[model samples]
Target chain A: MNREIVLSAFDIHRSYGSADASIQVLRGADITIKIGEVVAVTGPSGSGKSTLLHALGLLERPDRGKVLICGENGWALSSRKRAELRNRKIGFVFQFHHLLEEFTLKENVMMPCLIAGESSEEASGKADRLLERVGIIHRASHFPSRVSGGEKQRAAIARAIIMKPDIVLADEPTGNLDADTSAGVEKLIMELAEEGSRSFLLATHSQDLASAVHRRFSLGSGVLREVK
Target chain B: MKQKLLWALARRHVWSDANSTVVRMVSALSIAGVAIGVAALVILQAFMGGFTEAVATGLTAMNPPLHIYLPGGGHMDDFDLGAVQSIASEIPGITRVEGVLEKPAVVSGAPGTVSGAMVRGGNNAGLTIGMDLARELGVTAGDEIRIASTAGVEISGMGRVLVDTIVALAVDSVADFGLEEYNSSLVILPLNTARDIFRAHGELTSLGAFVEKGTDPVEASELLNSALYREYAGGGWPVYMSCIPFLAFHGNLFKALGLERAAMTIVLALITVVALLNLSSALTMIAMEHRRDIGVMRAMGLPPSGVFRISILRGFLLGGSGAVTGLAFSWISIFTINRYFPIKLDGTVYWIDVLPGVFPVTTALVVTLLTILVCLAVSTFPAFSALSRSPSEALRYE
Candidate 1:
């Protein structure tokens, strides 16, 4: 295979309300992503950056568009199939990590695999390996409440990759962390993308973070412009 | 595959979290409420069933379903000692017939103004009494007592001679009958004594018959009624008809409790509703608390139906546990009360000595069904809220 595109959104249109009070979130957005390619989306606030990320991640369906992931029509898919796609192919690491407060770090890391219907032993085994790779294995037993911010984000990253998703979607993943923790999480994110054989689509406000990725797309004036 | 995973995740969340525990606890309480209400109903209802059964069986065992006492009327023409016996024998289920004459009499320590006494003529030399009334009134067997009845007493106003002749006889048995109305007044004597002293000539006052076991009164009563009708026509006698079992013993005590039972069941079921409401609130709180986790599960491909199913399962689990606890409690209480302090009506008259409690298997099954229903109904609201929860909204809060 010649590294075919795993995610593509064509002329996507999304509006929040009826015609009179309508607030359009995505206006004819288009993007195609390939395997083993790290893509970063950078933009100022309110540029529909997160909305675009969500639409592409199968978390949000556009009002008008054909969203194809792994060459399957996702925008027209049933809620069941859409959810299946989200679970198996795409992993999300949010700005706040969004780790469940009640679960231990190990359980948190195993969430994606668990949701993918993997057995506890198998999920746990994968989660353990990922936690070790992300350097959060020592704190696997600690609940998210007890873990440090950096450790929590690492666990989130480990969780995102537990099922070995084809693509990782991170939106401002380091926004809530201090510089040192941000650097630590950034290293883990890069390591996950490389060692886990997964592509990353990162959306953030930091120029430094964008510069570190293999490619960057800056969202401005309702469009994604590739920046080499 | 996704549903199983979601359920596993949901179960873990349910098992390992305080909010989840509270949710399930509320459900358990609802189930318990159901179980408690149902068990209480079963226990209480069974008491009635047992009581009515004991009463009916006890009464039926002694004679026919009922005893027909012809107070003033002379002996039934077709109801000869042999005629009554023959009619009864003609029917397959008619077991025994004992023809007897009962008369009221006076046995007084004083003249004229005499205490009450009854002179009954039959083979029955000994009779029992209810314990409570016996203890209340101080009278015993072998004691000289007074009995009086104007069985043939004539009313001066109506010019009617409706009173059966009254006489007294030496009574037997201790003051064991608890009924105040029957205590120390019954005088058992021979038929000749009853007829001669009470002025009952060839006129018989009553005919009693016992029916075979396992024979329903309706069928036997119909059969007996036909035979009596035929006998009346053949002998040219005026025989007014009334079935004893139908008249005297219909287990009206249980019938009387019908409204009370329905009202109690409705009232107690309200407790289950309240518990269900409590469960709903608890489940709602839990659902809200786990919004982000639910979002995660949704993201992990859990269908909305799966979420709803898991909520229902949790409710059922809680309800089942509560039902077990409540059923245990009710069973203990009912079994204990029925076992030790059994209500014993006077056997001689009412046909039973000890009140009985019957636990039917149907009752247990019904309680379980009601528990599940109440719990699951309450759980749906929270599950709906969970289904509508958005991953974006949940993660925003997160």
Candidate 2:
């Protein structure tokens, strides 16, 4: 299958606030992921798990680091190029599901494809397939507000992979759901990862979710340590 | 395709029920504000334009489109009426040319009714008195009135003697010139009668020239002046004359109307500015309320420029809707007022019996475009403010 490394972050450093009174979040975080791999990043509260994900996802710039998506240096690219790279190569699923309330589940799933300049008919067709694959095809026409928590998360997952990105960065994807719903979402994630088409980088405090992935890392003191 | 997505995002954000009630209400108020401001400016311009047009029409009704007089307002003695007519006839758009003499006289009807009036002498026979003069003299059409002219006065060896000339004429018509001064004092008579009564034979005050419809009287006057100068110069006569257009003769009244329109435009433009300020506030509020959604969209890989474009598009939608609505409302209001409920005015004061309301299409278009520009300009600050916050910062709490 020629599973090549699709994403790599080297010695990332990020912080908040001014230099005089700053809160350093990610001091020197590093990670690498290959295609068709499911990796988990585990950390306690106040750890830099989400910060690392944000840095790698291109949503936030690191003070000192290199985020390589598909082996391209994202930080060195212009903001526009970086945005295009993010739209085409990386997708995100936040803890809150974060489905746009104004759009139907199908529309939310089609957004990344649309942003990537795909035709609506093509995007719509892909979205429907993804929705059915995620087992939320019945709720595809319902808005985010009208869908259940599990269904919204399923839609978010469907949306993250709509553009066939190299990696999906999930930050506590099931953090806001109940145990059964979380388990169901977790099962859905594992099943999608089993298809071996794209990689998954999941950041969660749940041990069960952390243990279910192919590889696992523990983040503390703004550093990552391989545990699996 | 990206532009289509951005547009879709903007449209959905603006019309989404997910927005807070406060945001929706503020948006509605902003739109209403713009509509009202545009409507006020348009209606005011329409009425002012109509009023100016009405006044100009009234003034031109009583005065000739062009008048030729001797330099320094002197009466012409032994004037060549045929030569002037021939010169005027050669010029295109000069419909007619006629010599006229006017003098002040006292008009009396019945035993005690007497009024001082200016007697205008033209080629037309019979006496046509002004409405106010006829009222003062207790005369109407078919009534006999005596006009006594004091233009023939002499100084004798003993003392100054007044050779008063009185003539009786039947009132032909009572004319309302829509002007207070003209209606209250003018008296029209035949040229022969006026010359005999004023003892000014073979003398004419001025030559009035009427122009064709849609012809610029100023241009016609200039042509006439040039023609007359060339004619007199060719004859080796050093005669000077002045040709005055209707607008130049009544420049003050028209200038006052123009000044009023300018002043009113400035005042009313302030209303539009205030309305746009409200729009700025509303857009700012919307930005604040939608901060989380903006974060989500950004996280979804929407560029900062795309976000800015969406914000601008929202402003265009809101402001464009308001401007169009205001234009339609103004047009309907003007049509209704002009067609069904025309406002009546005092003829003596306003010079027209009914106040006019005209829809000025060009002015409306200008107002709409300016409003949309202001809307976009105001939206810039909020759009920039929205872009100031990082996507992570906005989504931190969520």
Candidate 3:
């Protein structure tokens, strides 16, 4: 199994509003993430961090420049193709531990594999292993609304990694947690990247979460610069 | 693998999870509505068809398939009975032919007067009274009636070709018919009497024949035409064929019955449609209430189409279930009543017994198809309702 670069966002810019009222969210933000490297993005408020991650994730198209995932020109692809990549290659985690409230944790984790056309038996097995790995195995049968905050967050992480994707892009992964739970989540995120050799780009405002990663970059005024 | 997952998610969304069990209930209702509507429609159609067939039988029973009329200027002497019989035998389904004389007679009953009745005189064996006219005239079997006509040659003051009119004394009775249209005074006498009353002796006014059982009417008619051409044309009398099949002869009566059933179906089907509306909202609300689940499903990588498919299935299921239940109920009730319950009509009032409910398959099929189509349409809106929110938008809120 030969692994190569997973996702690359070339000098990208995104803007909104017409003419004079225009606002640039990301300008000339570039990042090429390898197959298994974990990259942490940290910035202050309104620093265009989430926007830059969105471009790299292919969820949002940049007004200029191209995005490539697994050597396919993602920017030029159809919306359906983009969705396919999002389903098969990349995983997303947002703040508030956005686990679907109606589904059990097991159903939530098994979703990615199911979308990729894996058999139910196989997907469930994979989901079980992932939940057990993340220490939420006991809560897998419980709905998201029934689970505790920390448990929900852990489930979200398990869901992101269930597909064994090339890149996992997370926005404020531990922003909703207390100090102690935030530390636990950061530990989980670090372990996920190291053991699976999966690339990660986690946007955060937390000091400890950013520092734990191998490399950290800061976003400011529509640009990303390496800080460490 | 992805498609399977997407399909599962779609199924769940449409069929629903615990959080929005009410939506599932709604979908169930939708399926039931469609099923019932469809089944009812089919059953109704069958009954209508059966009724039409039954009525057509009675209408065309005594009425011949074709009537051969002598051209207006022709001589009655040229009618070769033997030649006409041979030609008719060559045509399939022409079982019987009779020479007929039609007369315009004023029927005077003690209770009523019916003027200008186109009295058709044939052998007493084949005459059917217009039952509708009988009810209008209030005459019945064994009743006495008088018929009068004037012939210019009967009195010596006129030329030999003209006779002064005189009253024709005839004992009349009520005509027997398969349908309710006949109760009036009609005189069905022998051909000799018909000829004598009309005063067209040896000058046959019309020649008629009946189609034999177990033969196609059109083929028989064609054969009859060929035979008639060979027989009568050489005899110097041109006889033209009048084609009046059972359907063409009695179309109006059948149409009236059909329109009644159709109106009943339309009015009844609306009830199911209302039920389906509740079903659609229930399904859509289920989708909405389960928004987070949908988001979770999308995160699992199920596509939008999967979402659409599942919801529609749920709606159909609901409608179908209800429809079957309703249809089952209707079937038992109708069957029991039609078989065991005898509704007879008074001879003086209604032409027959109770109006029958016939269950035919073709009508049922058409109705079922329509019901399914309507259910499908209702489901479309609800199926797509939850899908508009993308995985991000859905998950972002949660």
Interface RMSD of each: 2.6, 1.6, 3.2
Q: Per model, how much of the real contact set is kept? A: 0.53, 0.60, 0.37
On a 0 to 1 TM-score scale, where does candidate 3 land against the true structure? 0.69
Q: What's the lDDT for all of these models?
A: 0.68, 0.86, 0.68
TM-score of chain A of each: 0.94, 0.96, 0.95
> Candidate 2 or 3, higher TM-score?
2
lDDT of 1: 0.68
Q: Please write out the lDDT profile of model 2 over residues B49-132, one tens digit for every residue.
A: 998887787778877889888777678754566678888999999999888888788889877998888988887778898888
Candidate 2 residue pairs in clash (backbone atoms < 3 Å): none
Shift of residue B338 alpha carbon in model 1, Å: 5.3
For residue B316, model 1's alpha carbon misses the true position, in angstroms, by: 2.6
> Which of the numbered candidates is closest to the native, going by highest TM-score?
2
Cα-lDDT of candidate 3: 0.68
lDDT accuracy of residue A77 in candidate 1: 86
Sorted by lDDT (best first), the order is 2, 1, 3
Ranking by DockQ: 2, 1, 3
| lDDT tens readout by residue for model 1, B1-398 | 55565555555555555344665565445555656665666676677667666555543443345354444554553336666677678888777776567655545532333444555666564543323322333445544444455665666876876664444444355543323344445555566666666566665566666666678767876777788778877799876643466434554665776666678667767766665566567566666667777676666566667767777766665666566666777678778877777776665555456667877568766866777677778778777777776566555553
